[model samples]
Structures are given as structure tokens and as C-alpha cells.
Target: MTGGTPGPPWSWVWGAPGPPRATRRRGGGRGERPAGHSRPTPPASGPAHPPPLYQAAGRWGTPRAAVRVGLLCRFAPPQLPAWPTAMATVVAQRLSHLLPSWRQAHQEPQPSGQPEPVFTVDRTQVPPLFWKPYVYAGYRPLHQTWRFYFRTLFQQHNEAVNVWTHLLAALALLLRLAIFVRSVDFWGDPHALPLFLIVLASFTYLSLSALAHLLQAKSEFWHYNFFFLDYVGVAVYQFGSALAHFYYAIEPAWHAQVQTVFLPLAAFLAWLSCTGSCYNKYIQKPGLLGRTCQEVPSALAYALDISPVVHRILVSPDPTTDDPALLYHKCQVVFFLLAAAFFSAFVPERWFPGSCHIFGQGHQVFHVFLVLCTLAQLEAVALDFEARRPIYEPLHTRWPHNFSGLFLLTVGSSVLTAFLLSQLVRRKLDQKTQ
Candidate 1:
């Protein structure tokens, strides 16, 4: 009466009471027994044992009500079946573990407080299709901002190796720089500008690549900015290479004659490469024109820069005087081409998506090739410097700011211009979304 209708008379089978003897005798049969029967008691009533949970239903309420309360409270008596109780506990524990992560990923923020750290989330929880494909489940570490890069360093994400590879390369180049300055007259020597430029370019290339990889998961805005900066770094590095070749390989007379033409051309190409990259990423289709625009200028710069060295290699008939740098130069070209191919085709991963998410991906391979290419270039430059030492003139003495100034001006102008254009395109994109 307190909760609901009574349970069945025989519910006492699991150690609870049944109908009274007089009541059963008077009724004369099971079919004659009425509803709302009081549960059975112990014959002597000294103290009846607590009933099994299933049998206790008549005492508290109906069988259905007691079962509902038992499940909700997780208070199933010792007599309840073991397997069902264990299953319920497991379900509850699983929900408890998963709910917090779900809330962190999905819930809106409190306006009155400081921002919470952006934790990594799975693909389903991320903004739909926000990242590149083949990244797979664990590889996608979404919502991690720049502030969390330290934490992300230890996390097992796809970009982890790509970021660290370039970072280590940058550190190696720094050590190489220290050794280089100690070995040569870095500041005092006039011809050291090209060497300085080479070091700077190497540092820029690695640092930009690492930063781009690090910041890519931050947000779309940061992603585009860092990606463009990385592209600019590539252009600047190629131009720096060209400067090293021009300074060492060309005569001062020829340089004087061609400075007007070469400087403008280099600047144009740098700007073209950067601008084209930004356009390729944002606007253009990933077709032939877009690919050509992105790759051609840097490829052209490498071809031209290495041409003079290649010419020298061919012209020198003495096998003994053959430059080791020339062999490395050839290796560098092969590595560069390999890197480009891996980047465009997304090889290995394209063959088996998600399998290589944490390691051995195309981007990681690209970074490795880039590092090798830079090392090869450094070796060649060092060798060229040694070869030209006897005839090396302090050309910077003649002009206070010549190739160094022009090179800096050229790169700066191009980068700034490309950045502004990218900003414009990004603005348009944002407006459309709004």
C-alpha cells in the first residue's frame, strides 16, 4: 500500500515469506488466492532474515519499482544475481570516465573566467574535416593551441616527428654556425657576408618549418600565417643560396655588370614563389598551374645557383682536383627532388592511409630530405670558400652594403608583400564564412 500493488505470493521462494496457512487453506487453491497478499514470515518470527533483492519487491513496492530503485541506487542485495550487478557497475564506470572528456570537448565556456587550456580531441569531436586526410584517429590532436606545444611535445601525434626533426636540424645548424664563426673571420672578413647569409638561411629554413608544424593545429588563422611564413622561408633560403654562389663563383667585374639585373630578378622570383604558395594554398586548385607556381621559382633558383658549380666540375679535367662538394651537390639535388616528390604525392601514406600516422609519413620524410639538402649545401659552400681563399678579395670593403644589403632588401620586400596579399585573401575567406 505504501508504494504500489503487492508482488506475487510465491515471490518468497528466494527466502522471503509466503501466504498464511489459514489464508491458503480458506482459499483452497492457488487460483483462488487474492491480490495484495502480505509476504510470508518465518514460522516462529524470532527474526526473519532479510529477503533476497528480487523477493523484497513486495515489501517496498511492486516488483518493477523495486528493480528500478535497485538499479538506480546500485544497492542490489547480496542475493541478487552476480553477473547483472557486475555489468551495471562496468557500465556506470565507463560513463563516468567518458563524460568529463565529452564535456571538455563540447561545452561552451564560462564568460566570467580565464580561458581553459585547449585539450586535444578526436576526429569526431573536432570541427568537421578541418585537417588533412590520412592523419587517422590518434594522429589528430585537435584544439591544441600554441600554449600547449610543450605538452604536445610528449604527445603521440602525427606532426610530432615532423616538428622535432626540423627543430633538431635547426639546433645542429646553430652548432655548425658556432664552429663556422670560430673557423673563419665571420665579422671581420668582408667575404663572410655570404657565409653569414647561408647560416641565416639554414636557420630560417629549419626554424620556420618547425614553427609551422608546431602551430598548424592551433587554429585556421594561425595555420595559414605560419604556413605562409614557412613558404617564405623556403624562398629566402633559395635566394640566399643564389647569393652565396654569385659572391664566390662570379667575378667582381661580371657581378658589377649584372647586379642591376640579377638583384631585381632574384627579388621578383622570391616574391613570385611566396605569393604563388599563398595563392596555391588558399585560392587555386591543386592542379598543374598551382603546382608549377609553387615549385618553379625555388627550383629555378636552385638550378641557377648550382649551375656555376656544375660548370666548374665539368671544366676541370683533373680527377684529383674534383670537389667533394660537387658529389654532395649532386646528392643534394637528388634529395631535394625526392622531398618534392614525397610532398606532392604524399607517398607511402597515400598507399596506406592511417597506418603511418605516428611515424614514417610523407611530411616527416620531406623534413628529413630538407635537412640533408641543407647539410649538403653547407658542405659545398664551405668547400667553395676554402677553394677561393687564396684569391678571396674583401669585396665588402669596396662597398659598405652591397650584396648583403641587396639580399636582405630583396627578401624583406618579397616576404612583406606576400604576407599582405595573404592577409587580404584570408580576410575575404573569413568574411564569406561570416
Candidate 2:
């Protein structure tokens, strides 16, 4: 009743102000309550008071304490403004239109699994282009995708063993080369050039053989191309073997005997071996004739390449000298002969045919034996290099030029031969299609 707002009439009795009375709106509209019930009035406006539990300031009775004790009701959610809600609705509608295309662009395509079935073909089912003489089963289907053929590397196909034998051999050779490099001064010593070339060639042939076996099932064109390159690898390895034997293992008297014509002849024979291999493949000759075409020149090349090793082993001052290098060389020769027998004779496979399809094939045996032969040859050559270092170091300064020149010549010619043969294969393929 004073100038300022008056207290409620019941304030003295209650010891606090009573709730404010609800007011009616100006218009007699929907703001009116029911006849017997009156709604509580809201505050005129400042900040809102917190809930009952949060009204206290002391820690023990606070809202946080209530929450920690699991006695608090749910918290009031934060209010989002209307403008942002409207904007979000608008953005959602806009983005909804793009959802399909966005999903397509961002989503990974599910694999179709078209070539999942990597079953092998029998000889009769095999395509003519992929035929082997005695290999009757386990031939992978022809004209598959490159990925499909590569996947067969893990699968059990005929060429699986062929692929892995050479692949593992390449890895083994690489590891050996790493160990061998530590012992020899490969870069500084000019005489180490032959050793380097031989190692490089070993890697080349092993890798190419693996790749050829792994990927040749792709198509006829790829088949010819890969095997042609494989022949080139063989040729390069042959020349490398010749260089190593000639430079490190030859007797002084034997070196004088073949020094003039040996390298040139070896180079020519390497090219010839590649030529024979490519031609044999190109002709698609079957049975023993086809194999003979492939193996004869390679045999001749091996004979020539190993002659120095043979002579050194035979003419060692004492047959029973326990010379480790000489022993390794003999082991190398033995492995090579066994490899040749398996390669040419087609042993158990020829005898049993399809029974040996995935496992006991001559080609796989040949690959393993050849790798052994190469390993033995490497050990022997390494020992010879160390033993003859003093004798050859003076002669090495002149030797590098000859060795590198011959190596380059051999590589260039082998590549040229492979290229020429591949072109011929392509031409023949074209002719057949026409």
C-alpha cells in the first residue's frame, strides 16, 4: 500500500511473499483457464531461476551432488534457436537431393568375383597355345586376365610349382648376393666386374623365369612375349657364367688356349641359345622335337660355358686336395647334368603323365636342380675370386674393359634376338587370325 510495490496481505502470517495472481489477457481468447483451476503465473522477465535441487549453493546439496548420487531428474536440454533449425531443415532438404549421387561417388564398388574359380584344365581341355608335351593336367585356362593369372601364383595350378621354384630361388640368390657383396669389393675391383655381371644375370634369369611362369596364362601374345624375354634371361645368364668361369676359374695355360676366341664365341652362342629358345617357342613344336629345339642350343652353351670350370677341376694339382672351390665346381657340374636330364627327359611326368600334374613334374625338378647348379656355381666362383685375387689384381685393370664390353655385347644381342623373335610370333599370330 506504499509508494513502492506493497507486500501481499498474508506475508506477515506466512513469513514470505505468496505466489503472484494470474492475470487475464486483454482479449477474452484462449488464454483463459477452466472454471475451478487457476494456472501459476510466470515471472515478468529476467533470467529464469534454476530447478529446486540447483537452487542451493552449498556443495553437498548441489545439482552436481544430486547427479553423482543418482537422485537428480534429467537436465533441461539446451534450446536451439528457430533460425538455425529452419536453416538446418533447408540444408537437409538440399542435401537429400544429392544423397544418391554422393553415395555412388563415395561408396566402394563391391567386387563381382568373376574369376574366382581358378580350376585347372586337362590336356584335352587346354588350348593349343598353352600346351606342353607330357603335361596332361593342371594347365591353367588360357586368355585369363593378368590379375587372374597372377592370382594363380598362390593357387595350385601346373605352373604354380614352376612359378614358386624360380621365385624362391630368386629371393635366395638375392640374399646370397647381399652376403657375397660384403666379402668382395664389387665396385672398386675391376676384376669383380665378371662376378657382378654373373650375379646380375642370375637375378635377371630367376626373376624372368618366375614372371614367365606366373603370367604366361594371360594370352597367346603375353605367353610368347614373356617366354621370349625368359630366353633372353637364359642367354644373359649363360654369358655371365662364361665370363665368371673364364675370368676366375681358368688355368693359365687354358686361358692362353681359349683367350682370343672364347669371349666372342660365348657371346655368339648366347645369342644363338636365345634364338633357339624363341624359335622353339614360336614354332609351337610339340613332344620331344619341341623340347630338343629348345634344349640343344642351351646344352651347347652350358658345355662351352662350363669348360673352364671342368678343366680347372680336372687339372687341380691334387685330386684329393680338399679344395672347397673345386668340390663346389664338381657339385655344380653334377647338378647341371641332373638338371639337363630332368629338363630334356621329362622323367616321372613322361612315365606317369597326369599323375604328376601339380607336383612331380620334370620342369619343376629341372627348375630346382638348375637353381642348385647356379648356387653351387656361385659359391665356387666366389671362392675362386678370393683365391685368385692376387694373381688377377694386376691383370684386372685391363680385364674390366674386355669383360664389361663383352657383357654389354652379349646383353644387347640377346635382347635384339628376343625382340626379333617376339615380332615373328606376333606376325604368326596375326597371320593365323587373318
Candidate 3:
């Protein structure tokens, strides 16, 4: 080709006419280039003219346009370099790995078909009926099933200690009764009957208290009902204590002064304690008035029930004798007083609200002290019964029907009171919902 004349546009194509083949001129034949001619420089590395499609794509301005060019380049001739197709394949593989995580990050989570976990909440999160004074946190949600409340007996919560203390106490009382029965003729001897009643009452109250604390979170209706029954148990215990004290612990002189009216008054006072407690809870009364209404009758009943023992203690001989019965009586009195103080004062819990939520509350302390008191009281009464058995067995010829009858009547009346009060509470709740 001459410089003055243009070569064909297809000159850049491989195998097209161009310079003489070097292999053909092995022996210097006609295949050799003319002496004046120089082999035309091979066209600069790539095709001399790119396809019009690439030219139209220009500088590949945007990422989307670049992707389109790459897709188009994928179908081009094998001689054309396919850098865009390789880049697109690499990008698609990277996106395949990332797409799931990106979708997961943006999508809402789905439920797993299991119940949501129950957690303890603050006082404000619970219903008003579940609230306690100075207790700010660790209230379980209300309206949970009975199984949930039973399960919570092992869980950490404000009521866990309360339920456990009374439950253990009830078991302890049962063990004590079993041991005591081995020594005394509980069924045959009238003198042992009063102590038997006391043991029975102790077991009743402790078991009822444990059940009350464990299951009361079911609802407002159940809360009132369980605690009302708890009050009845307390009343039964008080009357039982009174019977034991009057029969065994009372001095001759003190018994002479109060014998005519003592049992009757004690029975009345026991029923009164139950009535006051049930009424206080039924009204849902708050503050000092409610506290007084609940506390006063119980205090009076305790004062009456314990009077005979106090008289005997004060009038008895010297303390240096190391009398086991007297020592147990003293411990009983001390523990009862401590229990009363904790019950009324709400001590450490009042000082530090949420800090003692799962443990160490005043009510829990009261339960411990009360259990101790009952244990001491039982030991003292059992000793008193053995010591006075000979004296009482000969003097009292008749079966002491009066003592047992009054206790039974008191228990029946308290149960009736609690039942009536629970019905009233249900009616009030119904009215409120309406």
C-alpha cells in the first residue's frame, strides 16, 4: 500500500493482506519486501476502530449505564476483551453474599410461636390491687394462670420469701406435732387436747399463709379470697392459743378471777380479728385508718389470749432455776413482740424500698419471727401439759367440752366471715367493671 492511497478499512483485521510473510522469504525469493519498502507498523495493540455500540457508550458516565455496557459487552466477539463482563460477574457474586444480610437488617422480626417471657415489673406497671406500701419494684403481672403463680414460688420476686417462709414453717410445725404425739396421749388425755388444738391451728395458719402469698397474684378476686381465708386461719390460731393458755398456763388465782368470761371473750375477740381483717381488705382502705382497723382487733385478741400466760410468768418463782418451760415462754413472748413490731412498722422495707424486693422485707421478717414464736409457744405448752397432767387429771372429772366447743364455734364464725366478705368483694369488682 502507498501513503498517497488509503488502505482498506479492514486492514487491521487479523490474517488480512499486509506486509510480506517473513517465513515465505527463507531463501530470498519473490516473497521478500521491496528494498525501499518498510513493513507498516502493526496497528496500535487494539482494534483500529471499536464497534459503534462502545463509541455510543462514551465515557461510561453513570454506574447504571456502565452495567448496561458490560451486559452488552458479554455478547461481543471472542477477540474483544471482556473486562466489563468479568467486573459484572465479580459484582453479582459479591451481591449474592450480601443480599440476605441486608434484607434481614431491614425486615421486621417474626414471632417464634412461643410465649413471651414473664418478667417482674415496678409497682406502677401492676394493677392498683397488687400494690403494697413502700414496695416499688418486683411486682409480678396480674391475671396470670395458677401455674404461673405456682412456678413463681421458685422464681425471684417480692413474694418468694413470703411464700417460702410460711411453707417451711408449716412443714416444721407438722414435724413438731409428730414428735410431740409420740410422748403424749393426744387423743385420750383431755389435758393434751388443748396442745393438740394449738398444733393444728399452727399448721392451718402457716399452710394458709403460704398458699395466700403464692396464689394471690391470679387476680383481684383471688387476691381478696385467698387473703380472707388467711385471716380466718389467723383467727383460728388465736383462739387455739387462747384455749391452750387458759387450760395449762393459767395460774389458779388468775383463773379464779377471769374463768367465768374468759373463754367467751376470747372466742369473740378471735372472730373480731377475722372480721376486721376481711373488712379492711374488702373496703380497699388505704392509710392509718385501714391499718388501725386491721391491727386493733388482732392486737386485742392477742392481748387477751396471752394474758393468762403473762400473769403466770409474773407471779412465778425465781429465774435462776433455769426452767425450760419458763425460758421457752419468755422466748415466745419476745418473738411475738418482735413479730408484731415488724408487722406493724414495715421496718427495713420502709427505709429502703426496692432494695429489699426479693428478700429481707418486713413481712418476711414477721413471718420468721411468728414461726419462731409458735415453735417456742409449742415447747412451753407441751412442758406445761406434762408438768400439770397429774394435777388436772384428778381435779377435772368432766370432759372439757366447753373449751373445744368454743374453739370450733370461733373457727366456724371466722370461716363464715371470710366467705361473706369474699362474696362482697366479688360484687364490688363486678360493679366496677360494669
TM-scores of all predicted structures: 0.66, 0.71, 0.72
| lDDT for each residue of candidate 1 in 20-132, tens digit (9 for 90 to 100) | 43433342233422455544443352223433543556466544454454453334344344556567999999999999989977886645676755445556655542444
How much is 259 displaced in model 1, in angstroms? Answer: 6.4
**Residue 149 lDDT (model 1):** 68
Between candidates 1 and 3, the lDDT winner: 3
Off by over 4 Å in 2: 1-115, 287-292, 319-322, 394-401
Model 2 TM: 0.71
Worst 10-residue lDDT window for candidate 1 reads 1-10
- What is the TM-score (0 to 1) of candidate 1? 0.66
37 in model 2: Cα distance from truth in Å?
37
Which ten residues in a row are the worst by lDDT in model 2? Answer: 19-28
Whichever of 2 and 3 has more TM-score, that candidate is: 3
Report clashes for each candidate as comma-separated counts: 2, 0, 0
Candidate 3 residue lDDT tens string, 76-136? 6753654567679999999998999899788756457845548588888888889877788
Q: Quote the lDDT for 384 in model 2.
A: 82
Model 3 has a clash total of: 0
